[model samples]
Target: MSQHHAPRQYLNWLASLGLLLLLGLGVELLLQQYGLRQQQAEQQRLLAHANEVRAVLLGELNATLHLATGLASYIPARQGRIDTAELEPWLQGLFQQGRYIRNIGLAPDNRIDFLYPLSGNEAALGLYYPDLPKQWPTIQRIIASAQPRLDGPLQLVQGGRGLIYRVPVFLADQRYWGLISTVIDFDRLFAEVEAVARQRGLAIALLPLDAAQQLALTSTPDTELHLPVFLAGANWQLQARLLNPQPPLLRGLRLVGWGLALAVSALIGMALHSQQRKTSLLLALSQSQRDFLQAFELAPQGMALLDAQGRLLAVNQALCRLLQQSPTQLLQRSVMQLCVPAEREQLQVRLATLRFGHNDSWFLQLLDGQQQQIAVECSAAILGQLGSASEVRILHVQDMRERLRLQRLQSEFTASVSHELRTPLTAIAGALGLVNGGALGEVPAAMRELLQIAQANSQRLQELINDLLDMEKLLAGKMRFEAREQPLWSLLQEAVLHNQPYAAQHQVQLQLLGPPCQVAVTVDGQRLAQVLANLLSNAAKFSPPGSSVEVAAVVQGGHVRVSVRDQGPGIGENFRARIFSKFTQADASDCRQKGGTGLGLAISKELIERMHGRIGFDSVEGQGSTFWFELPISVTKPQDAST
Candidate 1:
């Protein structure tokens, strides 16, 4: 060969080598970017799973903690006395409702005086806190602070690992009564959370922040995410990691990219390689679509996709089974067609609004294929851009039959239990009354004091049962009202007089401020009196010693507003919203300092509303509170005016 021709051929080979190197660099960068995206997606998935497990863990733990608070509340309400006959049923009811409790024990003077569900927990019945040197300091700290604390996932005397929630019971005068201990089944609670994590291919570890070493409930040595779980005044760290940390598809893509870069050195193979890459992309897209379809089909809840007009675009087997219809029958049909006629028009309007991006949820009745009405809760959400042809909405339907059934059963059970409790309580109160009154014979002074305490608690228990029955009836819409025009002034006077004794007991005085006005209201006299009594008693209970609760009535805008004002610590901003919620107190300490079942205000609200009145309150944290109610004035008849 000529020397110049050989040099030109070598130059061409050099140019081809440079081009191959450039292609290899570009492919490597793209592969790295893809791997980064995969890692990000995996991290997000791990975080979501960790959050779900944390929520479940907190929910169960908080629910269990409330049981301890409830039992502690009982002691203060009874003036630091425990009646085994009455306490047994109360504890039993609480135990039945709690999902993870192993046992509930009441310790008077730091010795276990009573334990519910005594079968497996007999060994722990008489255990004293002072005997357990390891736990005595914690108990002392809790009692000294007068707060509830969570302790342990430690070994129990009953031969299992459990968590202990200890609540200190204080009497009305700030005397230390004892402690209430609730043992929670640690294995049962963590088992549920772990099961949920496992389903998502996750491993979780729960570490207590206070521990000297990292002690995990479940071990995940290589954690990718850390979340804080604050429950029952204890700080815990939840660490989570994906079980399959490496992505096989990403590794394969890296190998394939390098191989393709090398093949690109040959110019003739470029077009063929491009065509093969497009085919592979299409196959990947198809597989993704199949995976989505599988997930949609297997979802447990009834789900459907609908167009802007609410016509069914697609549905899952769950929806088909829920409606008792075939896929062919449901497809392309308007969702409103399945709803009862009374609700169809309203539902259609809501659907139209939802299409404009106002997502909503509502409860409605649907007609099955067999023409039976089924109650369901429906939630809707928009999927795409508003006003676009591609826009669709997804509807999630949950059957409410089981929920409704459970509600009915709960109401029936509450009513039955209240009735059963009332009978025995009434007899106990009557017998104690006779003994304390010396009707049975002359009683010793010391014995009389005990009998009087017993009688007072029995009465308190009876009132609580009555409140429970009234609340149940109100919720069930079974309460009957006998509304009649009554003189408002007379009602106010009677309430003040009735609550006078209770106010005296608290060392607070009751007074009427405004002059009596001739006002008549349409109301059930019995119910109105109950409302007034509740208000007056609450005012007296919270007022400072020697302070006065003032009751006043004034006419405003054709309604008479009666208010009860008190000069006390008033209400805290955070607790104001839940003051009327059943079974809620400002704090666990409030239950001890101020004795109440937390049902008075709630019951009063229900009664006032049923009688066509509105109830509200105004308060400042350090100043005081004024609770008021307004009712429309009854129109006086000519005959009554003449009289």
Candidate 2:
């Protein structure tokens, strides 16, 4: 009955999870869409505000230009000279009509000859227009082109920022005269623009399109909208940024309403389903009890039921046959009486815990009446728990002889194969070495290259055999470790010196950077050296010519970490997952061109684990890699300095 209903119950739970996940995804997507709409509206509003600000600013400049135009006609036509007495009254009336226009001047021959509001602007009375280097180019252009022009927000000779507007003056005979200029106080002009920006919740900045120009006026804002302004034929940008803008509250409330509705609906449906499930479970329990009784009696493995006191209450036919006893006779014995004397006391203690819901399995030798024993794996579970009087437990036992025998056979096969290959591989390597070393008399240069290839491959084969043997010993728990306290600095120096010749062959240098003071760690010194050598060889193999491999030791957390860094093409994403597996390489062709048994990192991981250390690496695809391992600081007494 349980077997039939279990899948339906699991399917119901899976459907509930999927429904909740889909609802959550829908809510997230809907919220994202609403957020996008709000952003678009904010951007459009900012753009509109920028346009309005530009209009207000352009109006101010045009009004000043108009005043300059009206005054230009009243200037008496002459050769580069202006009459101050005649122009003073007219300029005074213009200034009185507006507060933003600071002063008006008529300059002839590039010299200010006439001025109004002269009390504060006395410094400009005799100032030459072209003398100021910053404005000289624009001033000359206005004179040459005979056009109305604008320049500044510049530091005036008097004080304060001034926007100078100039329109070229001409005699009635078309002779080139100087110019008429109006000075607009920029502070007054910007105040008007800022008033509107404050009311609209925005910040504004006026920037020149020309990077070399020095007019800098800015305001801090959250989001930016840039608008192009053509001021007096000069390009500028008016940037408007919104102030802190809040999302619409109605949308948030609607989202919350939808979420609550979904949760409420799910809860109501779950309540109804749970009521039905309870009824189904009750029916299933009764039917399941009957099915369990039948299976228990027919099971092929031995099964037993025991009371809380560990006395056998019942035994299956299988148990009876295995013990060569009748069920009635087995029921008379307790669990302790069925175990060997050495295992009986321990089994009794295990049974005490096993009666309280501990479900771990145990291996024991169960004795029969004739005093013979059978090795079996036993697992126990509490069937009923109401103290010793009412508590009952069941035990399942399986024989493990076949599984142990197979494991031993596999381990022996691996060891024998590795041993058989080592002798022939060593003889082949020695013969190739003798031929390549000119021991058989001077050989042709062509034959020398062939002998060298043979010698290298033979040597690689010998290394492969050695790695296989080491892996076998580790798996069989036969590898011995002699861990002792050794200074990490000395170990690093030895590794660098040993790998220096091999690094030179590949044109890679090995450099050591050690800590300021010696730090000691418990490790097998010879095995640690092997790990370092393997890393150095791999680093050199993948590195470009003339690159260097850096070895460093540093204290991290509570352990000392030694790292090897190489500037080489890094590990690829596809091969990184299994990089530490035995007989694995990033590229199989690399094994052919760069020659490796590919068991180096795997063996290194095993050796480090035996010494209670950890090994890992960090790599970026095109940059390089850093492989490191950390061993705990030694707690043992320091060794003699010489050793």
Measured by lDDT, the strongest candidate is: 1
Backbone clash total, candidate 2: 0
Give the clashing pairs for model 2.
Answer: none
RMSD of each: 19.1, 23.5
What's the distance in Å from true for residue 551, model 2?
A: 1.9
Q: Tens-digit lDDT track for model 1 on 175-253?
A: 9999999999988888888998898888887776645323544333333767777676667788788887755343444
* Model 1: CA > 4 A from native: 1-295, 352-359, 386-391, 515-519, 554-558, 589-591, 635-643
Off by over 4 Å in 2: 1-400, 442-450, 543-546, 567-581, 584-594, 618-624, 636-643
**All candidates' TM-scores?**
0.52, 0.45
Weakest lDDT window of 10 consecutive positions for candidate 1: 213-222
